[model samples]
Target: MDPVSGELKLFLDREKIRDCLARLARGEDRRDAALIRASCWPDSTSDYGVFAGNFDEYLAWVVPGSPAIPVTQHVLGQSYFEFDGALDGDRACVETQVISYHRVDFSVEHRDTTIGGRYLDRFERRDGEWRIAARTMLYDWFQDSGVSVDWSQGVMGMPFSAPHFSGRAVGDHSESFFAKGKAR
Candidate 1:
């Protein structure tokens, strides 16, 4: 019974941690600071080549409305975990793969930069919750290419519009997954 219970707890904790990562990715893609910050502890640390600092500082760097990159998409791959058997199994290390795409536009031309990398993270489960304590983003490879797309028009020449019931909004008001669940 002891082993079974411990395994169950570990499973649940892993799920929670993965959920946090997913939310963080969604937050970045959606430009939702609150959602992004919710995944880390109050005193978490982040290192993204360009900057290395606390979670609050990280938020200040990317949060206030729109992220520097106008459009971004983060694709989560797999996560590997190393557990530290402490009380309540509070400590863990997770390495995850992420493929990110950022759009760069200079009016005359449109380009997309793609980055393939891993997020090496240390997490601590506090108060029955798992949150990132320290994170380092390791870049493995990257590529940039030019592309053309009109946000205002779709392939069929119709307005590139998201369905109202789809819960895809321009802002947090409706486009959010949370909003979609609460909407209907």
Candidate 2:
């Protein structure tokens, strides 16, 4: 193999790893089981504060819990990667930061919360495809506040924001329609 080709392969490998991280966030936000599965290896394992188990068990734990929360968002942040040149040449370790948001509307009061964390992941390339072999989440900090702003003032609590009578859904592309940022 030539030096130039080797460099290109490295670049492609890095991009694939990044894409896998993005897919994890997107799949979780959308509650897309198959999409989430694609980001991990068949024998992957996950450790999030509340749940720690095999990939299948992790899925079974999270999928049901996500819908129970009225609103949630997994905002991604910077990711750093390291490479090793040993028996596991195609293996890389990644540390990715995530800012998570959640909302709960109780009859008496509404609560808005945010959690900060990092995902420590082990990525492996199998059959030229990169996916997570292991993932561990580390929660750094968090804040929960009483709802102080009027959602009806912003584009948020408006009637036009909803497709049906109840209200707009959160955590998916459909909800992105009313968000502030430009579409991606």
TM-score of each: 0.83, 0.79
Model 1 scores worst on lDDT over the 10 consecutive residues at 163-172
Encode model 2's per-residue lDDT on 63-94: one tens digit a residue.
64544455667888988888676433689999
Cα lDDT of model 1 by residue, 62-155, tens digit: 6653333566778999999999965376899999999998776667676678999999999988888888999999999999876746555555
lDDT by candidate, in order shown? 0.79, 0.77
Best of the candidates, lDDT: 1
